[model samples]
Target: MAVALTPLSIPGRAGQLVSQLGDRAELHDVYDETGSRVYHDVSVRDTHEVRELVALVRRIPGAVLELAAGSGRLTMPLLALGREVTAVELSAAMLELLSERLAEAPERLRERCVPVQADMSSFALGRRFEVIVLGTTSISLLDEEGRAGLYAAVREHLAPGGRFLLSTVDIVTPDDPEAAEAVPEAVIAAVGAGGRAYRMHDYWPAGADTRTVTIFPAEIGDEGPVTVCTTTVGVLPVDQLGAELGRAGLTVLSGHPLPGAWRYRDVLLEVGVTA
Candidate 1:
C-alpha cells in the first residue's frame, strides 16, 4: 500500500549499498524485499486477497486491467484463471520480478499476462476493459490533482458497465478528537528472514489537513541504527474520497470495509453515464 524507500544497509556496508545500489536496486533492496512475504502472511491470517479478487473477476466479462500491479501478485492469479490481464506497473524492478514470476507459470498462463511499465495517473493503453483495479491503497499515494488525473484516466479506459475496484487505508480527521488520539504509536510493518524489522509511524504536522508525514525506521539485526525513510502522502477520509470520485464522474456503487482489511475499505464504482 505505502512505498518505503530502501533502508540503510547492514551497518558495515551501509555506504557501499548507498553507492552501489541504483534507484531500482534501492527499491528492490528495501522497498520490495518483503512484498510477497506480507501477502502470504495476510492470506493466512485473513482473506486471501487474490482469491477474493478472482471471485470478483468471475462475475465481470472481458479482460482485466490492474493499475499499480506491483510484481504481478494479483495479475498472475487472474491470468491463471484464464483471464487476459494488462498489468500497469511503474517500477522497473517490480516489472522484472513480475516477468520472472510469469515465466514460471504454464505457457497459457504466461501468455495471458501482459506487463506494461507506465504511470497509472497518465497511461494510454488505447483499449478498455470490463474490470479495472487499483489495488492496496495506491490511490492514497496521490494528491488531489493526481487522484483526479488517475480517475480521469480510469474513466477513459473503462468499458461501458465495467467496474473500478480499489481499497484505501483510513486516515482520521481532526474533527474526531478521540479517533485522532487513538493513532498508534508505532506499527511493525514488516519482518525479514534475517531478523530485521521495519517499523512505521504516522504524524500530522498540519492538523485538520489530510496530509500525513510517515516515517519508516528499520532495525537491521544487531547492527547500529541507520538513516530512516520519510514520505508524505495525502490520506483521504472515506466520505471525502467518495465525493472526490463523484466529481470525477464516477458513481460509488459500494463502499465497505473488506473482509480482513483491518484499517482499509474497499470501494466499487462505475462511470456516471446518462442514458
Candidate 2:
C-alpha cells in the first residue's frame, strides 16, 4: 500500500527530538567479547522473529527505518529483500561492526543499507518511512517515559498510513504471579561462530514492578566466561501499550503472535489520521 505523509503542524513546538540501557563500558565489553559477526550469525539467521519481520516488510513497498538495529541483524536481511533501510543504533560498537560487514557486501547491497549511530528514543532523519520496525523487543529496554519518547519519534518519522511493528517476550500477568517472580536460571541467548555461546539470566525485580532485569553471560570461543552486562526494562502489558500508542497518535491495526516456543509476539500500528 502507498502512503502519503505530510509533516504534522504543532501549535507550540518547532524543533524537537527524543534519546540506551546499561553503561558504555558494560555494553562495549559485552559486544567486544561477542563480535558482531558471531552475534548475528547465531542470534539472527532464520529465527522465527526474523522471518516474521521479513514477511511483514515484504508486504510494504518502500523505505524502512529499523530501531535498535544492533549489528545489522535485521538491517542486512531487509536490504537483501531490496528495501532501502536506514538503521538507527545506539551502541557505537554495534554500529562499527555493522559498517564492517556492510563494507564487505556487494556495492548494490551496501548502497541500500544506511547505518546511523543514534538513540532510538530520539532521532530525526529529516524524513519519514513507509515502514518502521523495532524488532527483538528493543523497546522493552526503555522505561515508561522513554517508551513514550520513542513512540513520539516513531510517529514523527512514520508516513501517513505507514506501519510500525515491534515484538517482545510475553510478561506473565497477575493470574500467574509465581511465573513473574521466578527467574530462569539460564537460557541460550546466542551462539556465535565456532560454537561460542551467550546465555541470558533474569535477576532482580522479577515480579509486579513495571521493570525487570536482563543479564547476558557470554562464552567466547577460548576466553571462557566474560563479565555479564545487565539491562533493565519495563514489562508493559498489551492494554497499557495500546494506551501509550493512543497517546502518541498511533493506533494498532492488528496484533499477531510470532511463531516460537516462548510467548513471543509483535503488533502492527498505523497512523490513524482521519481524512
Candidate 3:
C-alpha cells in the first residue's frame, strides 16, 4: 500500500530547515514503514527506562505482555527475566526488525518470545498476564477514545494480582506559563546504532495539550533528497490519567520517577485492577 505523505508544518528550527529544503524534503510519519526503520535504528541502542521497568517487572513473577513492543526494545529484557513474553505490535516493519533480532538471539532467549501482530489500543490473546507493560510514553500516542479502549483491554488481560506498568511524561518544571514557554523547546543531536546521525527537535508550548517531535539527518548537504519524520503526542497529566484509569476499573499501585533532567520528567506508574 502506498501511503500518501502529507506536508508537515513543523514549528521550530527543524521546521525552518524543512522550509529551506522545500522540494528536497521527504516527510513521513514516525510510525510509517520507512520511518519505523529509523526509529528501530536509534531505539535499538537507547536505554531510557530499561533498568527501572525491568526492576519493577522482576518484583512480580509470571508471564509478561508488552504493548507496542517496537523492535523488541523491552521485550528482549523481559524475556531475559526467564519468563514467557508476548510482544504485540501494529507495524509489520517493526515486527520484522524484532524477528531479525530474535533470530540471532540464543535459543534460550528466542524460544520464550512470541511475537504477535496486534493493536495495543485493543487486543485479546484469550489469556491473562501477570505483568503488562506499555513503556516509552506510548499511551500518549492514543487519543482519548483509543486510550479508553487501551484501558479496557488492559483490564481484561490482567491476571489476579497482576500489575500494569506504563511510563509517561510529568511536567515538573516552571509552573508559570511565561517561564514554561521560554524553556520548553530542545534540539538534540543523536547517533543511532546504525551509525546514522540525526537531529531531533521537540517543541511543546505552555498550556498546550500536545507536543511535536521532528527528526532528520544532522548533516544534510544541499542535496536531492532527505527523509524527515515527525510525530505529535498528547500531554497527559498524572491526575487526569489516574482518573481515567479509575473510571476504567483500574487503580495506581505506585509511581517511580525515572532519571532525567528534561523540562518534563518520565514517571512510571504501576497500575492494578480495583478490588
Better of 1 and 2 by TM-score: 2
Q: What is the per-residue lDDT of model 3 for residues 1-275, given as tens digits with 9 covering 90 to 100?
A: 22454444577677787888988888887878888888887778878999999999999999999999999999999999999999999989889989999999999999999999999988989999999999999999899999999999998999999999999888775767676678657888899998999988887877679888888898999778999988878999778898999999999999999876457788999999999
- Candidate 2 has its poorest 10 consecutive residues by lDDT at 10-19
- Candidate with maximal lDDT: 3
User: Which stretches in model 3 have alpha-carbon errors above 4 Å?
Assistant: 1-5, 175-179
RMSD of each: 6.9, 11.6, 1.6
> Cα RMSD (Å) between model 3 and the true structure?
1.6
Query: Could you tell me every candidate's TM-score relative to the true structure?
Result: 0.70, 0.73, 0.95
Candidate 2: segments with Cα more than 4 A from true spot: 1-42, 172-186, 204-225, 260-275
lDDT of each: 0.61, 0.62, 0.88
* Tens digits of lDDT, candidate 1, 96-137: 767887888789998887899998888899999989987666
**Candidate 3, after superposition: displacement of residue 117 in Å?**
1.0
Error of 2 at 227 (Å): 3.4
Candidate 1, which segments miss by more than 4 Å at Cα? 1-48, 170-184, 192-231, 260-275
Ranking by TM-score: 3, 2, 1
Model 2, 174-238: lDDT tens per residue?
A: 34657644533224466554565655443334443333222344533333333333334556656
The lDDT-based order of candidates, best leading, equals: 3, 2, 1
lDDT of 2 at 204: 33
